[model samples]
Target: MPYVFVGSVIVGPLLGEDAVFGSLTAQLAAFAVGLPLAAITALFPLTRPMSVAAVRALCDVPGESLADGPARSRTARGRTVTWFTLHLGFGGIISGMSLALPPFAGVLIALPFAAALRGSRVGMPEVFGEGWLLALSPVIGFASLVALAGCAAGAGTLLARWAPELLGPTPADRLAAAEQRAADLAVRNRLARELHDSVGHALSAVTLQASAARRVLDKDPEFVREALTAIEETTRRTVGELDAVLGVLREGDQTAPTAPAPTLAADLDGLLKRTRAGGLRVRSAVELGPQGPDALPPMVSREAYRIVQESLSNALRHAGPDATAALRIALDGTDLEILAQNPLPATGAASRRGGGHGLRGITDRARLLGGTAEAGPVDGTWRLRVRLPLKGPHDHDHDPKKPQKPQKPQKPKESA
Candidate 1:
């Protein structure tokens, strides 16, 4: 292989000088031709050692043949040491041969074996007599070097001539790698969105309920009890949800059964009732907005409830215990308007700057319903205003009776 590789290098320069390909092109030309030739021969795979010892033996053939082969009866560790010694003697001979001939030839023989055995132990067998090996090993090692050089040179030449294309990176491998990266990025994005929605809602609820419970402790024990209950329930629910989410990542529980998801239907009414109980003086004026024929959509109700719930919760937390929280909902043309507000406290925490997921989540929910939400401090009070399009959960068209008239009806023509 070494001779063949050197021969190609020399031949390339000569061919270029002959003007087969101009002088400037020869640099690229050598690699282009050598690559295809290397592929066709499949020379490297066949000649390479399966283990460190095999590589060393091939490189230092003469030394390996003369040295004592490892006793097949030896223990694995003993045999490994014996094998290593044989290779070291082989490598030394190859290195010496390089000084006698061209340095590249020695490199072509010894370097591959060294790299293959990089992590392996390189020691001689202590059990064997050293004098016996030391004497004949050098002579055998020199002969092995010459044989390996001759073989490497022939194989490398044949590969370079016939299968150069196989030597380079393939298009298929690159495509597979790119596809894996894309899939990883997609999974990360989904996890981020789920965490944002779950943790944001739970934390906001916990904070609001805790603050309210503290204020009502002395004045209204019953109300305080209710708020405390809400806190416990919310905490327990959050933990269960988190466990289920994390369970998917655990290897030990590969077959672990997931806890059933909590249903909103059973808890929503209790959720709403408790907030009103928590010193908010909440007034519920919610009425189902008109739907074309279909019933109210589950998402619409869920989002609407969240919007009102979060706003009132914030009102209780920041607007003071004595503050009056009012919630109103009514239909305005094709939209449902939800407005929640509380009086500014005489001395209390400043208005919360943004709607918690109660606000943001509601807004995102509204957007999903083709609606919108606005929340901010308004005229000595905090206001949450939302406009939800009045399309029932299943309705995709307007009600037939409620014809959309562009102009008022003209006077009847019966008299004419």
Candidate 2:
């Protein structure tokens, strides 16, 4: 239809009244001039989306076959132009056949009956025809109409087959979509880690505290009340961190709570007390520089707090009841060192070595910050050590996870 409208303006002036019956060569020449003029319009960005929609509907193409977005690249635009040109050419041919062929066929079918109705012999269509051969004219006309119908159906099939190849996502579009999927997966994974560390640690503490209070409730009213108090604090803090973790999902919403994530600067003291509530004896020495934990980068601090929490959670779970664990956090040069060690519980020697998903999450967290995590039984005790750079993961010339020599805790360096 577009070509028909445009061609009238282009071929109409050239042929004047002969537009319908122009000489073959003259018609071809006019079409040649008008074809490029029509095709050039397809290069516009809007044309790709419009043609994609039209092809899908009119050709009955599957929704997945054509891309929904507009032409965004040279390759996509080139394919769109080719498709649009084919659309115009085939539409013009089918339309012309629909208007002219059926009536012409009908007249030929009626020609034989004309003489019979008039009761007088009449001359047939000639290159000098008059007898049984005249009967062949109607048959030929009917066949011509059938051929036109077949051509139209075949053209529809051709367009449907080509629509997917021309209109589907380009390589660039596919790549962009893939990157978006990866980023979404990364965010979901980080949330999972945070939820696990926060809730798991809290649950372990509450369970231990409840059991201790239950056993001593008759003879030790004071201890039971303290246990209940710890349980309340742990649940309340866990719920707050849980909400912060879940906020990642509602990030773009106006109604989302703006709770800050857990970090060492704010949560380390509470974490130590929570570990003690879980029936693990914790002896700790944390010496950050004079600038204190608040001087660390937010990402480093947040991930560091989780790493410590998970390590302690592992100790609480696998180091058995009432085992003393040593926790040392110190700033050593440009690196922050976290070392957690405890005697392997008499019954948990093998189990302590296999800390499962919690240990794996800790390792991933440290690696994400370009740090290293090493946890295993050292001598007769289990040890978990991690090293993270204060400047985050991007500053180092070498891999932060690379194995380095074990160093004893030293006096913290003052921040400059």
Highest TM-score model number:
2
Instruction: Return the TM-score for each candidate structure.
Output: 0.42, 0.80
| Prediction 2 TM-score vs. true | 0.80
lDDT of 1 at 152: 53
Q: Candidate 2: which pairs clash?
A: none
lDDT of 2: 0.79
| lDDT of model 2, residue 38 | 69
Off by over 4 Å in 1: 1-266, 289-294, 329-336, 347-358, 390-416
lDDT of each: 0.52, 0.79
Compared with the true structure, what per-residue lDDT tens digits does model 2 show for residues 1-416?
A: 55444655667676664553345454455556656876898888888789888987788988776776778889988988898888878876787689778876776677666555223344234631565756776897799899998999999999889988988888887887789889999898888888889998899889889999999999999999999999999999988998888888888897877578889999888898878877888888777765567766678888889999988887887788768888888887888899988788787554455467888888888898888898888887889899998775544433567564544444743221
